[model samples]
Target: MPTWLTPEGKALSCLEKIKVLNENLTEIRELCQEALEDAVLMGCDEPQVRQVLQELLDSLETPFENK
Candidate 1:
């Protein structure tokens, strides 16, 4: 589990929010791990697969903006 932090560098304090966040992360991790394993078994380059995943994450856009 990670100590999720806010943009201001403070640790997240809401238990319900933290639980949801951690659960979401766990689900993503499991899915990604399965995909990585499948790719490796199919002879795909592990590093390339990882790079693509990172790029996908980097390309995400959020509609919410702080005012």
Candidate 2:
């Protein structure tokens, strides 16, 4: 079996990865919210700010896949 399929590895793999991803995404969301609030306070247009953030989010996707 592959290393990741071993008993200890399985025990420590998928859930751990998902938990870490969730934590990172949560932190990014909080930071983005704070930045967007600051941008609005400084008179940046809300829609434009959201568009830029959306593009940034899109860039993180894998190429050629419909995910």
Candidate 3:
């Protein structure tokens, strides 16, 4: 007999997906931070830098359920 996707199977898949997404989001945040730092070094306006960082912060917020 074939094994079916019980509740445990579903939870495992969800956990894996969240883990991958979390890693990707963290990397994106770091890249955004680096970009903002480079802009600062180039003497970009403070307000523009803040706006870019804020957008990155927003994207990092996940709506996933806590285990």
Q: Rate the local accuracy (lDDT) of all candidates.
A: 0.94, 0.77, 0.71
Cα lDDT of model 1 by residue, 1-67, tens digit: 9998998889999999999999999999999999999999999999999999999889999999853
Candidate 1 residue spans exceeding 4 A from truth: none
Reference-based TM-score, model 1? 0.87
**What TM value does model 2 have?**
0.65
Give the Cα error of residue 60 in candidate 3, in Å. 14
lDDT of 2 at 36: 94
Ranking of predictions according to lDDT: 1, 2, 3
Question: What lDDT is obtained when candidate 3 is compared to the true structure?
Answer: 0.71
Q: Model 3 — which ten-residue stretch has the worst lDDT?
A: 1-10
Model 3 over residues 1-67: C-alpha lDDT tens digits? 1222444565334566667777887887788778878998999987889897788667886587645
- Which candidate number maximizes TM-score? 1
lDDT of 2 at 19: 76
Query: By the TM-score metric, which is better: model 1 or model 2?
Result: 1
Total backbone clashes of model 1?
0
Q: Estimate each model's TM-score.
A: 0.87, 0.65, 0.54
